[model samples]
Target: MVLDLLVVNPNSSRSMSDEIARSVAAVDAFRAFAFKTTYMTGPEGAPPQIDGEETSHQSCDACLPLLKDPESEYFYKRYDGILIGCFSDHPLVEALTCLTDAPPVVGLLNSSLSFVSLFPSGPSSVITSNKEWVEILDASVEKKFLTGEARARGLWKGTVSSNLQVLELHSEENFGKIVERIRRENVERLGSKYVILGCAGFSGLQYKLKKIFPEVIFVDPIILGFQTLLSSATFLKCQNV
Candidate 1:
């Protein structure tokens, strides 16, 4: 049987959803599954408070109509799992799951951090779109993953920082320079072993950063989200049998 997985971009950015779909398509595990990517239509651009759980929840809430529309027939009926493509998994993720029948709702932020836990840690940092999101990102980490024995073991190390203007620096001429500067100032200066690109925009720069800092691990949120979706679909299939 073919498992249908819908990757939803909660914000109003179709381009981001397209990029996410492209990345997911590159994954070999998804070949056996039917994958669909959809974008929300409430906001014209990226939501301002995408880093916070509450704001993220609100964004997802605003986008629900699009997901439920009759036009999105396959997404509503055939999908076995839903992946929210936003970087922050708080209120938006919580809110989306509460209102929809979609089960095993996964967020990029949580999946990305969980992936980091598998790494041999020295220090790990999240590179977000702007400085304003740093606090939200840190809070989500502490609230969701940094508890119990995991916190005591110090398996997850390091501080979270933002690159100030990730969206503006998307131009080819500026993208390489900005990413290099972030590596030097944030990752290298602080002695971090891994870096998680917190925004979908940064997903496009993973190759450049890997080439510049070959020793450092760069976790791309889109890739993590896709992997999580693929894994969940596999697990769900086994259960149905």
Candidate 2:
């Protein structure tokens, strides 16, 4: 039997959704399972882009209802796993995991951090798109992941930004800016060996970044989330047999 996955963009940006599909297509990880996948951009009420706390809330408000509504198809269909394509700690994850009997759900932020926490690969960090995210993501990480027994190891260094918008990442010049930030901020200064591409828009950059930072490890959140979800699904499926 083939497993099915739902990849939710959480925001209504058409171009961003297309970019995400391209990134997912570029990866070879899906072959590990006989999997059917559906990609959904946010509906009419969701924000075009989620830049800060307010828009994050707006996107969740628009998406959470449809995911939970008894009349909606998603409420009844049981996917093997779900991937929430937001880099921030969207409340949708908390709602779905705690409030409902949802399948394995992986958020980009949580999956990336969880991976690094389990492995503890040197000093790791997250590269985001805008200035506001530096604070928003940093606080969220501290409030959630960087506490209790987790703090002793100190895997997360900090969250860095390129000061660009979501669509701007498509430009050639903006890509250069990201490379520079990774070099100046993450490499030379911070000495980070593991970096998480913290934006849902930064899907296909791993190959390019590898060419420049060959020794460093770059984690694409979307790919990581997908892998984590599938791994969990495979494990849970085996237990029933």
Candidate 3:
């Protein structure tokens, strides 16, 4: 049985959507599971990158109509599951769940964090863009599971910044060098054994980082979100058999 998955990048950049697709396609899990994925960028006028709460709200607002658009009926009618390709639990995740006959909407942040919980072996950390996002994502972790649970269980050791703007991470000139430096510091200095790619802009960075660091487990939220949705959908399909 093949899984039909729709991954929505809540930004106007087609490159971001493409990166997400490339990353998910490269995962061993997806190759083993047999899945077909369609990638979509948010509607026109959405921000290029979601940095803090305001852009997160803007992206959510921009994406809601696309999900329900009559022209893109496949979004509503075809996929077994939908993955919101943003590192935060952007409001779009909850909003999509409220729609009638909506497939399971998996947010990257929620999926990655939940995945981290299963392996509580080391100090888990995140690498996101900019210092401003530090508080935005921290609140997300707290609101989803409750205060102190992430830290107390060692699910979230802390969050570090790349110091680059969110959109910059996707630029060809900035992608590799920037991600390598930040990840190196997080592994070498911050004691991040398990590092979450806290920005969706860092979609395809995992492969490169793994080659460089080798010891650290890089958790890219988009990849985890895809795995979560596919596994959940496959399980439900089995129950009906």
Candidate 4:
């Protein structure tokens, strides 16, 4: 049976969606999964955080109708799973799962953390562009079942910076080089086993990083989330009989 994996980007940026596709393509585990991506309108192509909780709630609300419109033709009837590719776990995911006939919905953060737990003892750090998102990532880690394990392994570190736009300018090879340098420094000092790219825009960097640090496991939330939902759907189908 074929598994259709829909990755919903809660922003209108096509570049981010394209980056996710490339990252997903690099993973051999998803060869059998039919992958698709959709961009949401209303939000200013980026989810708000420092703008306050009310703004964040409103932005999410604006994306709801787009997410819930089942007959919108963008809906994939054959899709076996859905993945929300935003950094934080958007409420729209839970809302969509409850309202639509869509398959199991997986959020990027949750699935990435779950995947990270499978790694051996060592610290794990998240490399992100927006420093403001560090809080949300921390909260996610706090709520994970592997929190104890993470603490026990002393493999938890979170890093963020205000260099968000650096990703948009692909011509700036120095930006990527700087990021790689930071990753190398962090892994060396902390001896981290896993590194999670915190933003969907950073998805394409996984393969390059893997080549540089072959010993370090790189966790791309979009890929991990898609795989998690796909696996869950397969298991559910078997159990249903």
- For TM-score, the strongest prediction is 2
Q: For residue 156, what is the lDDT in candidate 4?
A: 75
Better of 1 and 3 by TM-score: 3
Task: Report the lDDT of model 4 for residue 180.
Answer: 55
Q: Local error of candidate 3 at 27, Å?
A: 20
Q: Estimate TM-scores for all models.
A: 0.72, 0.81, 0.76, 0.68
Minimal lDDT window, size 10, model 2 = 24-33
Question: 76-181 in candidate 4: lDDT tens per residue?
Answer: 3445666676756566566767764677878887787777776656667777655566676677677653467767767677644434542452335645654554
Better of 1 and 2 by TM-score: 2
Q: Clashing pairs in model 2?
A: none
Q: What's the ranking of the predictions by lDDT, best on top?
A: 2, 3, 1, 4
- Candidate 2 residues lying further than 4 Å off, grouped into runs, are 1-33, 147-150
Name the candidate, 1 or 4, with the larger TM-score value: 1
Q: Write the per-residue lDDT of candidate 2 for residues 1-241, one digit (tens) a residue.
A: 9768777899999899999999767454434558777777888989888899999888888887887778876661457777889999987788788765678888999888887776565888888988999999999999886644446776568988988987687688788899999999988777788989989888889899999999898998998899898878876665564
Measured with C-alpha atoms, the lDDT of residue 89 in candidate 1 is 54
Each model's lDDT comes to 0.68, 0.83, 0.78, 0.64
Clashing pairs in 1: 53-91, 56-92, 57-91, 57-92
How high is the lDDT of residue 197 in model 4? 78
Model 3 Cα lDDT, one tens digit per residue, 6-112: 88999999999999999777554433446788888877978988888898899888888777876875466477788888888689889888988887789888888
Which candidate order results from sorting by TM-score in descending order? 2, 3, 1, 4
Q: At residue 139, what lDDT does model 1 achieve? A: 76
